[model samples]
Target: MNFEAAKTLCRSFPGVTEDTKWGNDIVFSVGDKMFAVTNLGEATGMSFKVEDERFLELTDRPGIIPAPYLARAKWVYVEDAKALGDAEAAELLRRSYELVFGKLTKKLQREIGGA
Candidate 1:
């Protein structure tokens, strides 16, 4: 998907926020934590977190790769947007939001819940 489409999808998540971080990378967040990031200026790819098992399955798929440095645990990179359709991209974003939200502290969860 194009940048605008990507941004639109990301912003649909509850409390999701976007900004440039780590040298031109576009980062999407819920609360203060990141769930997805795009290297639009340099790599033309997006990095996102998935369950460890799911991350393995996705990285094994064609055109998907383990995100550099961040892949040791839960991140994967979509090397080309064309390899993933809009539905898949939205699913990934949803999974990421769930994963990150699940990890938030009880107080934070309550705060986010109130939002």
Candidate 2:
């Protein structure tokens, strides 16, 4: 997908906020934990977290690859957006957001929900 579409998808997740963390990277997070990021200048690839088993399965797919430095942390890169349709990409991003959101402490969740 194009950069704007990617950004929009990232922001569609609940409690997700976008910020420019690393120089050119746009990061999407729930609280302070990142779930996805992309280079602002080039839409070369996007990074998103996945469970270990799923990460392995995805990276083994033809057009997917391990994220550069974060591969060991179970992040995967979608080399070409067309490999997975928009719906699939949205699902992957949603799952990544949920994975990070699910890890938040109960207190944090309540705070985020304005408890």
Cα lDDT, model 1, residue 66: 92
Tell me the TM-score of each prediction against the true structure: 0.86, 0.87
Residue-level lDDT tens digits of model 1 in 3-109: 45766788787778888887778888887899988865554778889988788788888878998888985898887777678887888878998899888898888
What is the C-alpha RMSD, rounded to one decimal, of candidate 2? 1.9
The Cα error of candidate 1 at residue 23, in Å, is 1.7
Error of 1 at 52 (Å): 1.0
Q: What global local distance difference test value does model 2 have? A: 0.83
In terms of TM-score, the best-performing candidate is 2
Best model number under lDDT? 2
Q: Which ten-residue region of model 1 has the weakest summed lDDT?
A: 1-10
Model 1 TM = 0.86
**Candidate 1 whole-model C-alpha lDDT, 0 to 1:** 0.81
